[model samples]
Target: MEHSDEWTFADCFHAQKELYRAIISAAVSIRWMIEHDFEVPTDADLRQMEAEVNRELCDAWVEIYVLALREWLDGQ
Candidate 1:
C-alpha cells in the first residue's frame, strides 16, 4: 500500500489494524499515567502531555508502518 497524506481511517483500518490498536492502547496508557502519577496536574501540563503523546504516537506509527512495509516488500 502506498503512503499518502490523503489516507483515511478506513484505509488505515484495512491496511493495519494492529497499528491502530497500538495507537489506542498508547493513548489509554498515557491517560492512566496522568490519573495515577499526578496529584494535581495543571491544565497546561495536561495540554503538553496530550500534544507530546499525539506527536510521539504519530511518529511511532509512521516508523512502524514503513518498517513493516519494507519487510513485506523484501519477502515478495
Candidate 2:
C-alpha cells in the first residue's frame, strides 16, 4: 500500500518510477477485459438505452499506454 499526498510527486533518480507502472496496470486491465469477452452483452436497443462503452474503454487504454511511453522515454 502507498501512503503519500496525491498531489505530490516522488523523488526521481532516473525517473519517479511509479508513473509508468500505474499507467501500464490500468492499460493491462482494460486489455484483459476485452480479451476475456467482458463485453459480450450489448445494450443495442434504443428503448433500452444503448452505447458501446467497451469500445471507449479500449480507447482509454491506448491513451494511457501512449502517455506512459512518452513519459518513460522522456525520462531516459
Which candidate number would show the highest TM-score if scored against the true structure? 1
Q: lDDT tens digits, residues 1-76, model 1?
A: 8767764544544466466556766785578577778456568766776677666667577666766566556554
What's each prediction's TM-score?
A: 0.38, 0.33
Worst 10 residues of 2 by lDDT: 44-53
Q: How far in Å is the alpha carbon of 33 misplaced in model 1? A: 5.7
The stretch of ten residues in a row with the least summed lDDT in candidate 1 is: 6-15
Alpha-carbon lDDT, every model:
0.63, 0.47
lDDT of 1 at 17: 45
Show model 1 residue runs off by greater than 4 Å: 1-37, 63-76
Clashing pairs in 1: none
RMSD of each: 7.2, 12.0
